[model samples]
Target: MLMKAALMETLLEKFYKNHQILHKESFMLNQQNMKIFTQSWRPYSTLQLKGLVAMVRYNSESSWLFELTSVAIAKAGFLVCAIDLQGHGYSDGLAGHIPNIEPIVSDCIQFFDSIKVDHPKLPAFIYGESLGGAIAILVCLKQKREWNGLILNGLMWEISAKFKPTWPLEKLLPVAAFLAPIWKIVISKPLASKSYKEWKRKLVVKNPNRKAPGKPPMATALELLRVSEYVRRHCHELEVTMLMVHGEDDVVCVYRSARFVYESAASEDKILKFSKYVASVDW
Candidate 1:
């Protein structure tokens, strides 16, 4: 009995040692004086790393949800890193209030470039979900020939028409945005109900930090609309290899928008995959 107990203790010790070796750390990176919360999952087992995957998270969401995914990637001998965008997660700025995407995109470039410089020999890829996907595309576009590939899940290529603001509100958005950019306006329908599947709906509510406002600030809404259109127009100019996955039943972002990018992109290697479930399942 003593020998058996000793064996169990030894196994437990190895488990904890391996866990320690995974090396999970969080730090603040200063970008223009904004403390961007960044996290990295790295494997300390070998020198020849699989690759580095720089992640951009979904809209109104933080990098915390990506922790499990990052750990899995690290276990597979890869380095995974992600940053909380301005106004999301633990980062500075008003929550869920991005008036313009340019600054966010610039932050990505600066942080990602710094990571690349540290590990100059490792091949790097970009992975994004929802709004993060758009940011990833803009980043890759700005630094042409820098990244190896892109993996986007449930990308916000198109904002569904149903989610758009009501007639008068839509027409008056420009003026309202100018007048009261910080005012939060509720949409006719709740965004959470449409975003997650029936089973995963509870997970959304379970998150303590989840930003649950269905209505966006007028400025943010207008900026999102403009950004989607800009990405749609310029998607064809993308030269990097891309793999886009989307749920067919997604009521948030239109699936056709992803198809449009696949068809429009000048990339020699690009793929568009449609899934059976909803957006929540894709992640």
Candidate 2:
């Protein structure tokens, strides 16, 4: 029994040591003056590396939740990296607020371009979750023919009308967005309960730092609505190799939007996958 215990202890020690050697790091990336929080995990191998994957997280969430997924991808022979966008997680700005997504897209392009210089030979892929998936598509559209591939998990191609603001409020959003952009209006129900399955929903609730309130700021809400429309109009412009996987019954992002993007994109190598239960990949 003592010998078996010792063996287990040795295995645990090696596991942690290997994890340490995987070259994981968290640092602040300066996009102009905005300090974007970023994290990365590199495979602990001397062999030729596969590629680099840049992760864009779902909205209203931080990079912390995506850390485990990044590590897993790194272990799969790719250098995996993720960032907390300006308004979310440890980054600067108000919680869950972005008046414009173009700046956010610019920040990603700058960060990824800087890193790619250090890794010139390897192909780079963009992986996005929920709202991040929309951001990834826009990024690819901005820099056409640059990315090798795109992987979207439960992407927000079209937000369900159930999440939309009510009649009078929807009509007032234009002026409200301009006058009081920071006002947190209840547009939809709480996403945590709808986003995950039962057991995983409990885990999300237990995350102390998670910004559970799904309320969107006046301007931010307006921007998301506009962004969704813009993505739909230009979906046919997406020409990169792509794989989009979605849950059949996702209430947060919906399933039909995923199907629309898969069918609309110009990419010949695109694929759309459906699963029994789907939610954010950051978990």
Q: How many backbone clashes does candidate 2 have?
A: 0
For candidate 2, report its TM-score: 0.88
Q: Score residue 192 of candidate 2 by CA lDDT.
A: 56
* Clash numbers, per candidate: 0, 0
- Model 2, 66-130: lDDT tens digits are 66567678778887777778778778878778889888898888888877788988899999888
Checking candidate 1 for backbone clashes, the offending pairs are none
Among these predictions, the greatest TM-score belongs to 2
| Global local distance difference test of model 1 | 0.75
CA shift at 93, candidate 2, in angstroms?
1.3
TM-score of each: 0.86, 0.88
Q: Give the per-residue lDDT of model 1 (tens digit) for 228-281.
A: 788988988899988899988887777887788889889999889999867742
